[model samples]
Target: MSVPATPMERSVPRDARTSTARMLMICAWLSLAIVVVLSLSIGATGITLAALPDAIQHWLAGSDDDATAARHSLVLLEIRLPRTLLGLFVGAALAVAGAMMQGLFRNPLADPGLIGVSSGAALAAVATIALGNEFAAPWIGTFGPYALPISAFFGGVITTWMLVAVAGRHGQLMIGTLLLAGIAIGALAGAMSGLIAYVSDDRELRDLTLWTLGSLSGASWPKVIAVTPFAILIAFAIPRLIRGLNGFLLGEAEAFHLGINVEATKKFVVVTTAACVGAAVAVAGVIGFIGIVVPHFVRLIAGPDHRIVLPASALVGGTLMVFADILARMLVRPAELPIGIVMAAIGAPVFLHLVLKRGIGGVE
Candidate 1:
């Protein structure tokens, strides 16, 4: 007879894990810096690198009175700043949510959008619009600014909770079952959204349709401010989940044996995912595949550890969205294409390649 190893003995390999963690941190920081610089530099109105900092300073100081200074400030602060920051926050939030969903389900292809959260949020938003109450309610209209994002966030939370309750049992999420349930829920939401669209006036219908396609063109300071708190809160919460996510890789029973509270971890993962994805959808509509694409690429470079994977996904996701936004702005020049279309255009082919190269089950 042989004695079982102690919990500490069965833990992740320390030396290799530490090395991987360091590499991921380096890559994440570098990528984040590059994206920020690139986002600030490029836009519809040209702003040279040398003048960028001055524009930012003038905007911050509320002293941009000169024509050149005012134009640059408008470009940086009003247009590029909100859009880029929203993209950064939305991208980071979606990627982290995707990372958590993958870890929770132990399925590499899992994404919050695919699981009906985005659709759910979109449905709710479209419903609000159809009701002619996009900003008419006293509390929301009084605030005047935060109404859309606030409504969208609540829509995401409610839909995600419904999905979880419908799909889960005693805190256990069965991957195949969950996917099927998500498909069903998404279809239902999509159908209802269509029904709402059919009965609505042309203008409302068009607005709702455009909203579903996703665009950062609507980016504004208020939306950026609205998404910031939830995004930061969720992103901050993700690091604390590193250990539990790592535990998930070793199988549920093994994780439980290692002192992980599996049920609580699952619940936390679900709530965090909903919160993050909901905020993104509220702000950006349904920009797809950032969640699915970014985490896999991060794992390919940084390995499968959640600690590294989560942060690296955020960095990579932000960069990808910023670039995609650039392309969206430029692709139709003077007429913006939806960011969702741009992401799907890029993401679909790459996703197919990853699927073929790794096979469905092989991605993990």
Candidate 2:
């Protein structure tokens, strides 16, 4: 259970001052735009930022006569653009999903990963990699290139549904019950994934290992399309859930007393989070820290206003992911490091500092 904030804290307008929120929003937008441009312009190929307009023009105008322009266009259009877009969508999805989960649970640490979604997705992906020729043959045959992503998406959805079922009492969903059930389910899913990994051949092991570590190296236009709808779903949800999430900070009973449809809010959050995290995991593998770290960081900057935190988290998260992807490409030169590793290296110390300095008193 979350510790309730004091009366003085609750009395703050919108749970954040307007000036701070506005400034954060401005900074977030600028940061995102800058990082996105950099992500497209910088890579192992040494593409200069100034040349992007020409490259884009060449690509759009279908001019292959200039070999230099053609190469730049190919790199920009086919590779970096899709990869950058994937980072944006995946990052935004995870961050907003994290913010929503934290608000719903009234816990500062809450994220999609807390509820077994990532674990379930990882388990399914690993299983597909390890057992596709055997147990998953039919689905693999049908899905072909799409089999792993499909498995991951459904795996997350199924796990959340099971969590909901186990945590429901009478007609109401208990936050405490849901949290406990999620932890148990997440642990179980992790164990199952480990078991599958244990029995896999060397080739299967390599594939699953890399998949779990996470990357945008496999990013393409299809993946960008696949994850975009879920990102839009999360965007649409933020406005509707803002009031409920704010009221939730006062506790479920208080939210109910405030005329918020607590049950409906809970269900919507669960469904949206499942889809968002599922699509993100399906495309980028299990990139961690963005969900937990981005929202918390946003709250620190913008205050606890869901109005500020949600959208700001989306911007900051997307910025961070694109920046991280750039680092992943450049840090090891031609051989890329897993983006997940880069995220952990960047996020862990920051999270530890926040916890130590602020104490975990549940998002006040």
Candidate 3:
């Protein structure tokens, strides 16, 4: 390093990096488009691939006078559209949050829902459902349909704050202790949900169990509208923090030496992760492992840079969830399997293989 090359030359990696990034972007978009086509075409009613765009156009135009137009519009807008959008947003949010959690803890195995946030949200939702039963108590029965999600959001936020507080010391955070504390809190929340289920009447118990298992069956335009802001905000915010996250890979002291505001970055990650994952859990119940599995898969293909990994994860996660949702719908024909169960079933084998192949630290 006789001359210590110019800043631009040192900072930018030249054409190879640019070309690889462009190729990854192209592949991600192609994957997303394929997933969308599969989501629209594979349902029980069976809309043809050719007719799908026309159906979407007519629905958008609001000109549904003909029987075919009305049927197509009804299926596309009312059923498939909401479900597809929910899968997309929820997948993106969960994957982004998972990536942030892994970066924050410097651990490849870290996942958003591994913390208490999702479990806490689920427990709160179950409580709200149980309490809102008209037969249970007149005072609690006043809660409306929206109460459960609101309760879940609040539960997630509170639990996340508690985790942060417990894991922080003198402006420093301990990742190991944080993860352990999350496990402890998650166990407590799970037990509380079980107790609530045991005490509830039969109808409420059934509802509680269904909520715990998780489904995108409750997806609707209103739910999408409610979750969109948080999901989009976090999705956009995460990529901007990529440089900071990259610094974190060098450890806190080296990161700080590189001009990263380590504490602020950590806090931002924690809050953003909480907001995104909380919103997903609030709307989708306890869907799991997309965060853990999708980001790592993307990382394997895209490399360790958060710049590529985060966006790639978002696209792959959305595609995976949309396909999984399709499988959930068709798995039992008229009756639906829980999306959470489907994700866990797929994710577990993949996770085990990763552990065996790369150990807990993941691929370099």
Candidate 4:
């Protein structure tokens, strides 16, 4: 026979858990800072942190009078900084997106790719690569570097809209229908993307291959700027959904009774998640597992509270990406491995461990 817990016993654990969660939140932010610095410092060119200050000062001085300093500064300002920032943004967006999806679906294993968003983005990106010279020329001319990302973003958006349309009944979103529809649509999108890749010329095929594997080699100031708004959009929207998300953990009916607009919250989550994942995929290609792994790790340290889980996931996600990018650059030295490959190698093992130890419903 089991003994019942006293109120004091329960209250003490709650206080201790809250304290531990807060401490982990701070630790997450600090880890992000450390990784950002490391990302800016360690690379093929090997810009030491000690020289980073001097490099920045020279880069801002607007004169290449000192050839050595100019080279270091150029590498620092032009290459590493933008790449670091992109990692942070993409990491945060993808991880937070995973957190939101997990909360919405009430499943610890959920990810944005479950709903065809990544597939749609990939299909559109691949299509642009194959057909850019003919069909996408006008878009290329008009948008310049923005064209591919823009296409991918819209592809994700259209996929989400379709998911909503197919899964909604009487103004209520059915989770069972959504999951089934997502799997079917996602498979279709993947098939189409494969078909496009199969017929592409050598150059386009190479580009498609590199992109589908994912890389930050194309990181630039414009790409960073493009993804910033979406990152900010996710950040701004998270606080409003915190209560609803926490209530959602108790089931949709309980959330509705707590005065949460269950339907509205569902719509908001799907929209924001799509936009976040879309923009991340747009700039960085199809980097995976940051979404799934980061949130689960955060929950392990910080507990399952969305208040801590969401923001902490963003911080930890960005940190993980920056670190992964570092390894990608250093592992092969000059030739650079794709960031996605590094992520998969690292994330797959961790995810497997989590599953074995905690099981699927272990977020609590």
Candidate 5:
């Protein structure tokens, strides 16, 4: 009884752009939720999603006196849950940081690592892990778990500001200039980290290696609590940069004429990106490419609108990281692979393809 002429109607769409972005964003959030659940369920000691509810119920009710309940609680609450939470937060931070960096420089290749922020932060953390025990005991004791994060945060903020100062001219940041400066600074930070590694004892070397390679194996509730603020900052505060970031898609002159605070925007982005990257490094070591990969992928699906790009990047970034962490665990069985290696395996090739196809200039 249906009309045969409905082929034309099916081909026509109304405001598909809005609908598409909305759907993408929805799917992104759903993907994050599903990934988090799966992350909890798939480790060496498995906890299936179907079993999660009863586990939570017994855990909450404190009726978990039985050995099986105790085992589930130990696995879920003590080990898997913290890492899963850490992965979620760190992933979101890295992704948002990458998106913000790209938008700030108006170059798709602009990443947190490129700016020397991650290297500088990692250097600080490595120094703390390698030598702070002997030299800075008082401060470390006072700050406790916060000492490393605080040092890394300061290091990141300082490095990022130095880059901004060097690259910013009359409120305009030239992409090429910043990229060159970032390379120089990042190399210097890497050298310092290497020096620290050279002087480190076997124990210190092990710690440094893990920090650089990146892992959630060290995930603990305190570390989760440590990173929560930066995570919230990324999740909520960074979206405010969308308007200014959009303005920068045009020239800085154009953005200024449009009443955007070009200088302040540059500073805001550099500082926030530095802090976010620093916190992430302190918690998970040098996990790379989340920022670059997630945002670019989001842009492909959602167009270049910073508004859609930022939040979507955060969601997708978190989800992608969860999956990566899962793979890192499973790839080596009882032994875990570093998260950085997983990310590099994926990101390095994507970066190479972009360079080959788009060339360096086309990234802008």
Candidate 6:
């Protein structure tokens, strides 16, 4: 029989925890709505809140020959709208991936960037850009918009498989081993990327620079459409993983004893993470920190239950990127900073606080 619990061993009651978790979800969605409105309202063009209704209505009602409406439609529908949507999707994807990784590894620092997924995706994308015009011209011409994303997805999946092989030992995953191997892989990938960047012509060089650093300036209907399926699938998939992830926090053996298929869950997580991160990297280059930081922030407010952390992470992550994109636009006037830089700037403080509060020896 299980031993009797002391006061410290007692946990929050189920109904109470569920009540609070529901409230957290409500708040997260509400905040995301506010951020979206703010993102729409603030942009380079003279579009204001008042103009938004007519601008959207005009687009929905069919094209207007009026120059003013045309300009508003161009700015809102073509540019800001897609950019905001991309941020939302990419941010939500990275955050969900990070949360799952953290829960699987049982560590806060198990980031996509640190685990070789992002770097591998980046390397493949850079290689695609480097070779697209010269070697893969036929594929590029045939695939047109999808060639790079396809390559990135395969690269991310392969890298995740390799990482798991390297990091798994004695039928267990070691956080430290994964960290060390990830660093080595990331270094090699970075070096390869740099070498490719060195031999490129001006336009190729420009593509390399933008993609390597990361940005949402390339957001368009095509890019947005490319990422939608991954984001939606991940969103749809999160509900299924909650029970396994929650059990994981108690320990894997306990999870298995509770009737969980531990091996299947691990494989599912790795595969889903690869798909999510791969799609985000393909479209947005490589915005980092969101994956590592947003889930922790959600945990701070909503508690560490994966049921709460996963969905809350999605909403909070979407809200964060939407506002970050807004700040990126307004920070340097007409010239915008890379969204990656913006994420790092915001995530640094949050990460520092988590480290300090949790301490190196006390990250559970």
lDDT string, candidate 5, 242-352, tens digits: 889999999788989999988888778877888889888888889988888888877776678888888898888888888899999999988999999998897789767
In Å, residue 127's CA in model 3 sits off its true spot by 0.7
- Least accurate 10 contiguous residues by lDDT in model 6: 355-364
Give per-residue CA lDDT, model 1, range 1-364, as digits (tens).
8776875676658756677778877877787788777777776666755677778787777874677877888887788889999988888888888988888778887888777878888887887778746445774666455666677788888887787788788767655666778778888888998999998998897778678988888888988877777877876787788999999888778789999988788778878888888889888888888998889877765678887888788888887888888888887777888898999999999878877887653553
**Which is better, 1 or 2, measured by TM-score?**
2
Task: Candidate 5: give its CA RMSD in angstroms.
Answer: 5.2
lDDT of 6 by residue, 57-149 (tens): 778877777668767877888887888899899889999999998988788777788778888888888989987788888878998878887
CA lDDT, every model vs. true structure: 0.81, 0.89, 0.82, 0.88, 0.84, 0.83
Listed in order, each prediction's TM-score against the native is 0.86, 0.93, 0.88, 0.94, 0.88, 0.88
Clashing pairs in 2: none
Q: Which window of 10 residues has the lowest lDDT sum in candidate 2?
A: 355-364
lDDT of 2 by residue, 228-252 (tens): 7887797799999999999999999
lDDT score, candidate 5, position 245: 93
- Looking at model 4, which ten-residue stretch has the lowest summed lDDT? 355-364
Candidate ranking under lDDT, highest first, comes to: 2, 4, 5, 6, 3, 1
Model 1 misplaced regions, further than 4 Å: 1-25, 60-65, 133-140, 143-145, 167-180
Of the two candidates 1 and 4, the one with more favorable lDDT, higher being better, is 4
Give the Cα RMSD of candidate 3: 3.2
Specify the highest-TM-score model's number.
Answer: 4
For residue 130, model 1's alpha carbon misses the true position, in angstroms, by 2.3
